[model samples]
Target: MALPVGIFALFVLMVLPIPPLLLDIFFVLNIAISVAVLMVALNARQPLDFSSFPSVLLFATLLRLALNVASTRIVLVNGHEGGNAAGEIIESFGQFLVGGNFAVGLFVFCILLIINMIVITKGAGRVSEVSARFVLDALPGKQMAIDADIAAGLITADEARTRRREVTIEADFYGSMDGASKFVKGDAIAALLILGVNIIAGFALGMISHGLSAGEAGELYITLAVGDALVAQVPALLLSIAAAAIVTRVADARDLSGQIGGQFADPRGWLPVALILAAIGMVPAMPQLIFFPAAAIAGALWWTLRQRAARPAPVEQPVEEVSPDRIDIADVSDQTLVTVELGYGLVHLVDKDKGAPLLTRITGIRKQLSRDLGFVLPQFRIRDSLDVGANEYRVLLGGLAIAHGTAKPSRLLAIDTGEVRPGHGLTGEATRDPSFDCPALWIDPAARDHAVSEGFLTVDPSTVIATHANQELLRNSDQLLGPEEVRALVDDLKERAPALIEAIHPDPLGLAALTRIFRALIADGIALAHPQPLLTSLALALQKTQDFDSVIDAVRADMGARLIARICEPGERLKVVTLDAALEGAILGGMVDPGTGQPLIEPDCGSMIAERVNRHIDEAKGPVALIVQPPARRALAALLRQRASRCLVLSINELPARQPVEVVGVIGADNPAHQLPAPTEEVQAA
Candidate 1:
């Protein structure tokens, strides 16, 4: 309301006639506003801190233009009345400031105009244009950086949002300033034109209407015209300077003065200044007295700054003191689910000065695994360990060593994947590839091209470690997931399908139960990458049963087609290994767990089944599924989990009806043989 009323008042001044007293008050107010804006611009720590500067500049320019119109009207109508006819402020400028000399006043006004328009306004406009363009061009990169930080867990979602908002505001501020600078440039030009109008119109009206001679009209009208122009030009110059200062500012923690003062406080910069001034003072042609005093002041400043630089920074007080007897939980236990411990010799792989190649590889692995797996993997920790050999690194899961290998930091590993030429001349140490147990040679980096020519795949030491870690992590992904990950998954799903989440969570199932279900699914090779469909399947499964195993079995049956799709493409025959009917029945009835009421196979029988499954897989030379009865599925899956991990075990009901099948081998048969089942309707549907 106040702003609207003030704007209305400005327009009123331009239209309605005002007394000299009121006009004088407006003149003082315009000058005060310009100074206030300049001070605010200088005091701002960053351009965004004074985000309203563009609007302030606009309003101030408008007020000055209005004042010009009111003053011009008064000057032309009353030039014959004398200098005081306009106002005391104008009168003071015309008589005292310029000593009643219109020519001198005109010359002074032109000097100020040239300084404002050509020097300050032009330069500020150019700066604003370039700054706006650069900021807009880098906007996407800034946004991407914030998102990357969020993905790396370096910042939370709220922090990322705040940073994104700040980036948008900064871009907007600079863009506004880019256009606002034109206001200053135009205001300068307008002031010049208005001054011309006053002089030409005042001279003509005085001679024609008031019947005065040319000299009298010139003396009376030109002086008041020059005075009015100077009064308006003073504020215009202040504003142009203000505009320049705002656009030229760089973001800092301190204001402009403090930032400049802090940088100039260095004693090293001052010593050279003092020496240069002293050398100039010794020259005969220079002003000796003035130059000597300037040299002495510079030398004194250098000494004072040197003393300040020599002072030591104060030490901060410790927040808390630890007792010698006290033991902390963090010291005794590792909180991270996954940790990579490097030996002293391998420490250089993770050094930042060396580009942290190992860390970079690990981050890439984490991102890839997060996409393949369902949930975000927790951050992995890297630390130095003395327990391992100098060239060895160990990966730990839940504080237990899961994988350990050695890497030679000074050489590359040339892997022989049955492709290397026989008797190729490559000299290095012989070793086995830790990732796949392939034959490999640790060759010099200089021989990488030769190794490639000999059909050897060359990889650096960091890739070897990172690849090994990735394999181990993928195999143990079930262990990486917890209740927190499940909660996050649920929260994310709730955003898209709240009703679907509401059907299963906190009603028929709790968070712990859902976490266990998800872990079981992941262990069975069902990724949570597409949770909407998986959760929807789970929600439908909950409609029939609430028992943990029953719900899991139901969901697995619902998602049977997706599971089959992961291993075999559409319209392709799936290579399968089935159990002998008699053997499967025997195992299904042999033993039952009292707690789970689930059929369990005897240890010897389980080992025999696992061995046969592994043999069938080797013969097939590709991924094969072991199809069994629903009652015997869990028992066989557990038996072959570690021994024949490559063979996927599925129940009869879990196999999709439309999937084509080829019976590659029959496990537990008298003579193992490959048999293609007839293309009958029943076999095709199974």
Candidate 2:
């Protein structure tokens, strides 16, 4: 509203006659405003700090032009009376400042106009144009760098958004200045035209209307004309200089004077300049007085700067003392459920614009594992780490580094798929696979086709990190489940099977107990994808006993088919790698009690069984189940849990009736496969 009203007043200024007092006030206001603008331009540290400068320039230009029109009106109508007909401001410039000579006032006005139009305004426009063009050109690259920093975890999402906004403002400021510079150029041109019109028209009105002699009319009218032009042109010149200062100023953290002073404060840079000036002073044709004084001043400045540099900088005093109570434990919580920390070189693996597959692969892993495990997989927090090698990445579980490996961002990883042609022999740069620790090689992307032909599995750096992260999530699925996840399961169950959930032991089998049971199941490699039987088994098991081990045993018994499905494919005979009858008997004998369900195996016996089972696992072609008796199954699974990650201990009752069994290998026995039963009808059908 104020801007429109001001513009309306500017138009009214041409028609209305201003008293000399008011005209003088407006003239002073114009000069003061121009000085204020110049001061602001000099103090601005960056272009964005004065983003409103371009619009201010446009308004100031219009105000000066409007004032010129009003003063022209007054001069033409009343010039024959005296110099004061226009205003005291114009009269002072005409008579006193110009020594009552119209010619001197004209000369000063033209000189100001030439400086503004030809030098300052023109140069400022070109600078604004180039700055705007360059800023626009660099905008996309700046945006990409911000996004990369966000992905690399060097900055948070909020910081990235702020930087993007700054980039936009910088581009907009320069673009506005590019167009606004035209206002200064036009103002300079208009000042020249206004001066000419004021002189010619004022002379005509003085002679025809007031009937003055030619010499008298010329003297009186020309004096006021030059005065009005000078008053308006002075403000115009100040504004042009202000515009030039704004456009030419480079961005720094300090104001113009501070920047210049700091840059030249060093004696090293100015010593050579001082020497040059001193040498020039000694030349024959050079003015000795001017050049010698300048050299001495330069030398003095250099000496003073050197003294300042030799002095030690004062230490800064702390404003506030740090207290022990101010230490926040939350700052070091360190309870990250899952995270992937990338080294700087692997930072590109998380960049979405680069089509990095790590984040997408992690999402897919969460989705697939959630369905397979019957519990939501926790989100993995991806970040960057400077502590590791540039090509390395680490997978963390529960804030502990669980696995780490290196990848080549510009190369492909080709795993020895175990089916390579003879003599091919893993030909590329050998490395261990991050996901499974399988022997693999990093090969150039150009060699990917050849690697694939040689039966190697080729993957990129992103896929390598992602696969490793996914495997870790699955392997540590039990540790990842929390009370919050358990509550989510209960809430979901209540929606579909309210009464079934309600029937469970509310006193002994709450969310915590259920979460423990699920953790135990997942720890033993049980998939909870079908929750109905597990819930039903838990409801029944809790009715019999509140003991956790017994209840977990019953749940495992009830999930027998689901567990078997994990080890055996559809319609395939289940391969058995069992223990010798004697070893099984010893394990059963080692049990402290069947009811208490304690395993008291001797150390030597326990070590021997673990070694045998691990050996069998190493020899197996694919997944194989270890069939044990019902009483010893829980204790034996617990015993092998630490040593053999792949081995599954199953009780005979847990086996599906229709599935046929083949004894492929046995722990603690020789020729175990030779002891296999001849094909029964069920085995033949399978």
What's the TM-score of each model vs. the native?
0.74, 0.57
Which 10 consecutive positions of candidate 1 have the poorest summed lDDT?
145-154
**Positional deviation of residue 587's Cα in model 1 after best superposition, in angstroms:** 2.8
**Candidate 2 — worst ten consecutive residues by lDDT sum?**
671-680
lDDT of 1 by residue, 1-686 (tens): 98999999999989988888999999999999999998998999988998998999999999999999999999988879998899999988888889999999999999999999899999999999999999999997787666545543567668978999999999999999999988988998998899899988888999999998889989999999999998999999998988899899988999999999999998888778878988998999998898888888888999999998899988888779788999989789867788889999999987655667787788788879989997888877778899999999999999988889999989999999988989999988999998878999999999999999999999999899999999988888899899999999999988989998899898878998898999999987788999988988888888887877887888888888877877677888888998887887787777799997888787888788888778878787777888988777787788787788788889889987767788888767775556665367866666
Best-performing candidate as measured by lDDT: 1
Whole-structure CA lDDT of model 1: 0.87
**For every candidate structure, what is the RMSD over all alpha carbons to the true structure, in angstroms?**
6.2, 11.2
Candidate 1 has which clashing residue pairs, if any? none
lDDT of 2: 0.81
Candidate 2, residues 1-686: lDDT per residue as tens digits? Answer: 98899888888876788777877888898899899999998899977888899899988988888888888877887787887888899999999989989999888888888888888888989999999999999998787676555544457657978999999998998999999988888887887888788777777777788888888988988998888888888888888887888889888999988999899788998778788998998999999898888888888888999999999999899779768678677777864577788899988777766755676666567668889888776555788899789998998888788878888989999997687777774467888887777778889998888988888899988888878777877777798888888888878888899888888735567778778888988887776677777788888888898888778878777778788887787777777877789887877776485566575677787788788777766676676788988877877777877667677789887876666777777777775474444457866577
Model 1 spans > 4 angstroms off: 1-33, 51-100, 113-236, 243-253, 257-320, 345-355, 415-433, 436-441, 449-458, 591-621, 670-686
